[model samples]
Target: MKLQLRLSEWQLTQLRQQEQNLQEEETYLVTALNERRLPMGSSSESIARRLTTTGAGVRAVQAQASRQLDQVRAENRRVKHLEQIARAAAAARLRDAEARALEEMTNLHAGRRDRTATTGWLDSKE
Candidate 1:
């Protein structure tokens, strides 16, 4: 019996999308971090206040993005591990099939040899 591990096309597509989303989130966080590091001293008080608000918002976004990236990485790892297991199972099945085939061939050859020997003995007595 073979164990099948199959992923649907839609499932694969969804996984690819999730990976893309993780990449986008990482890029967004990097850009936000750069913006946050920019100088705030040159701005007026009100502008500084706005910048502070924006900075806080960006920090929150960065935290969430980091968490999401971690989750995506974990999911990717799990999928890869599953794929490896499936491949190993498939290889084992192939090996088993080959071994069975070889054993059957050997048995067939032995049977043929026995028949030929019996025929030779009958001909000798005739």
Candidate 2:
């Protein structure tokens, strides 16, 4: 669980970093598209295409980030559930062990009582 949680967190961090980078790329592309002058050999059509492609890239990263976030939440919930199960199991085992110990103690004392009754301790033949 610890390893899974750490991996999920790492993936989320990576997705966030990707999103930030995509945002910067989209911003730069939008700025370029808004320019009036056509740079060197680049045409307006090419600039528009770049902006569209950047928008698509941004959307893809956002979707990926959303998926990663969901995975993280699931991993967290799963870990908590597993922990609860482990705790319950441990508590049950402890209860069983205690019950057994109590039973053994009762039997031991009962045997001593029987033995003492059969041969009186005051008679020194026990």
Candidate 3:
């Protein structure tokens, strides 16, 4: 279980990093597209074709970045779920250990001269 959790966490980290990179790539593409200047001597038909192609490229990058972001969110959710389960399991183990220790202490003190300690005076009806 611990190993699985660690692996998932590592995967989540990798996914986030990948998503960041994609976002950076998208940003750069958008910036480049925005800053583009029409060539001074270009024919209008060529200029229109160039604008169409760059617009399509920017749209494709945006779509890919969004998809990567979704994957990162999913992985993040998985890591959080695994962490919650690990915490609950640890809590259960701790409770079990405490119960066992209490039982052992009771057994150890049973032979003592103190009767109240054995009978659990704290549990008395009074």
Candidate 4:
């Protein structure tokens, strides 16, 4: 039996989307910082502090997303490993069952009466 991994495709897609969103957010934050850094009359100290804080927030979120993605990937790998082990065990069980059936058939045929044995005994008696 083919076993599906525990991690669903939708879940993986969501994780990837979250990672992408985090990267986009980081890019937006950096772009905003760069635009503000230019002497466009908004390089005031308070604005600089606010942008720094926002940048820090973006970094934090990106780090969290990276961690989540790593965890999800690790869980997927673990589940895949377990599925492989289960499949191997199932195959081994099937092989064992087939071997047992073949052994039984061999034994059954060996126990059956042979026509040669019966005819030879009758011929000797005659």
Go through the candidates in order and give each one's C-alpha lDDT: 0.63, 0.85, 0.66, 0.67
TM-score-sorted candidate list, best first = 2, 1, 4, 3
Worst 10 residues of 4 by lDDT: 1-10
Per-residue lDDT tens digits of candidate 3, residues 57-102? 6566566656666665676677788889999999999999999999
Clashing pairs in 3: none
**Regarding lDDT, does 1 or 4 come out ahead?**
4
Cα lDDT of model 2 by residue, 19-84, tens digit? 788789777666766766556787778878877887888789889889988989999999999999
Where is model 3 more than 4 Å wrong at Cα? 1-37, 113-126
Cα RMSD (Å) between model 4 and the true structure? 4.9
Per-prediction CA RMSD (Å): 8.8, 3.2, 9.3, 4.9
Model 3: worst 10 consecutive residues (lDDT sum): 30-39
Which structure among the candidates has the greatest TM-score? Answer: 2
Tell me each candidate's TM-score. 0.60, 0.77, 0.56, 0.59
Q: List the residue pairs that clash in candidate 2.
A: none
Q: Which has the better TM-score: candidate 1, or candidate 4? A: 1
Q: Residue 116 CA error for candidate 4 (Å)?
A: 6.9
Model 4 residue pairs with clashes: none
